[model samples]
Target: MAEPTTSSRRPGPGAGSPAVTTPALERTRRRFLRRQRARRWLAWRVVLATVVGLAGVVGACWLLFFSQFLSVAGVEVRGTSHLSPEEVVAVAGIPTGEPLARIDLDRVESRVGSLAAVRSVAVSRAWPDEILVEVEERVAIAVVELGGRLRGMDADGVVFRDFAQPPRALPRITTDTVTRREALTEGARVIAALPGSISRSVDHVEVRTVDQISLVLGDGRRVEWGSAEQSGIKARVLPALLQREARTYDVSVPGQPTTK
Candidate 1:
């Protein structure tokens, strides 16, 4: 009976023990996997949504950035003295309803400056639908009669108008009848280089040579300014010299003032 009392039991470790993962553990692992998969899916959704939003923004910008929704509708003129708006517009070459992207300010300014009346030019954009053009006209200082044509000269070495009939108010420039641009340029400089006081007091200027500049004042006095150089020094001494000196004074030499 004692021999037959031994049971069929095996070892200490049991298969159903909680030492290793089983069906219940597998169920817990499945739940964990499901949660991880849900997180991965959410991350993908976020990535996709961001990509879609960026694509939409780029598409909208591409569709609208330069679609020509607005064009040049008007023109504005400023700082103009002699040239008319129509004349400036004609030189600008900006057609009505032109796309703003096509308007080149440099080209427009260059074209406009070709006009004889325009001494200087500044062109700019006036917002999305307008253009602003500023022009400075040649200030007429004298008219030179040459070869049966009266040629106008400004104070800035620029000769512009040629008149068959001279204007009444224009001062007469009686010098060599040479109509070359260089000569005219010299005439313009002669007119333009005078100081405000000298210009106001003087009636006419004669440029006989490069350095021989003579001016006739309002009171019938003569001024023989040698050249346009040392203008500041000459100007400084002019008031005192004219006060003490005779009817004629020459201040072309900066350090020396000669009176006649």
Candidate 2:
């Protein structure tokens, strides 16, 4: 070596001398680089795992719910009167073999209640394989002319059905006095309260105001019932009174009977 020169550049934060390498320091730096690379690899692996797990979860859920695995096995009905079971089911349009998860309850109810006989309908899931349908039927009490058609009425004057001809057993309620609805309402309630035997005997009923109410019997006799309220009681007592009189009896006072 020539003359030994003093170093111009002082050691930085890590470098100490040029000739002697610090093996412990170099090992520490090398270890740090290795750890940094390992951290990057671990982060990449986590991202890849998250992406794959999301894909698998989506695939599994799609296979379970969307697949039509379960179906409507049976349909049960209650509260049906005039409407047949087959007709009610046909209106429901509930698809067989369709998944129960997708069962449209509102759609089914709206369909079946379209029949005139069905006043309201309710649907419930019976679990696993069946659906239950409960319906409220429209009671047929009498038929009255509505808009030139014979419309059916219940005990509450609700006109549900319009047919060309009235049913055989149901009474024909008629009036020429402009066919007032208030009279029909009062008549329906009064008719519903009468005894079954007496109510059934009425062939024709008229709602021609308080003074001119009339009833034609099946026995070729006429009753002079003055009003709808008293007529209900008259119906209950008319048979006994008729036996005594043999002619028309005004049982409007209910307990008192006068022959006509």
Candidate 3:
């Protein structure tokens, strides 16, 4: 009776279920799983490599910027003529042992350029252990009386260094009233235009207003220069006019020059 009941059910495999695996198939599946595991390990290895690379870059940045390995050990000055290297370095105030990459080049340049003698300045890092500062000094083109002291004026009309006595090579600039910047600028333009031969004979430059400028020669000869306009033409004509032995030469209108 039990055998007859068992005949209604299947014994080899369950209905709608897969067949049991063979030992070879099991081994193949295990190898495939091992391969998948190896692939996963490889992916993890790539991720680990990327992380290690980033960490190395971060470490290198730290060593370069934050550590003393790239710090400034000295300050080097160049292109300094009127100012001594020590003076430039002292004013630069660049701290030694600071990170070279972090040094404020603009700040350093500003400090160095503040010196009256410096016309322009550049600051930069000089490799592993130095900060380089290059400076251009202002050249004296004329001398002006300021506060009873003679001061050197550059071509840019900036009155810079003070002198105990007027320089023999440079012409004196005098303003009728108390020194005004506009008058000085006009006088500077007039003086700058004079030929070397003519400039060498000049005694002092007279500035009344922006448009009123004149020159007095060492021989007590006066030159009426008027405004700073037509300076090149005036410069060309003055030497010839002076050859005529005039006490006063008017080259304000260079084309219609007059001598008295």
The lDDT values for all models are: 0.75, 0.77, 0.89
What TM-score do all the candidates reach, one by one?
0.67, 0.56, 0.81
**Candidate 2 runs further than 4 Å off:** 1-67, 71-81, 84-111, 162-167, 209-212, 226-232, 244-248, 255-257
Q: By descending TM-score, how would the candidates be arranged?
A: 3, 1, 2
What digit string (tens of lDDT, one per residue) describes model 2 on residues 122-211?
998876667789999988788888668898888887888776777888888887857577778766766676677776788887777645
- What tens-digit string does per-residue lDDT give for candidate 3 at 1-260? 45544457655656877878899999999999999999999999999999999999999889878999999999989997767999999999988888888898999998988999999988888898899898889988899987788899987788878888888999999876565798898888888888899999999999888788999999899999998888999999998898897899999899999999
lDDT of 1: 0.75
Highest TM-score model number: 3
> What would the per-residue lDDT of candidate 1 be over residues 1-260, giving only the tens digit for each residue?
35657778866678765576789999999999999999999999999999999999987665444445557888898877667898888878897777665688899999999999888899998877889999988877778766667888777666687877766555566566543555555656655665666667766667676677777777888777766666667777777888865888888785888888
How far residue 9's Cα lies from its native spot in candidate 3, in Å, is: 23
The full ranking of all candidates by lDDT, starting with the best, is 3, 2, 1
Listed per model in order, the count of residue pairs whose N, CA or C atoms clash below 3 Å is 2, 0, 0
lDDT for 170 (candidate 2): 87
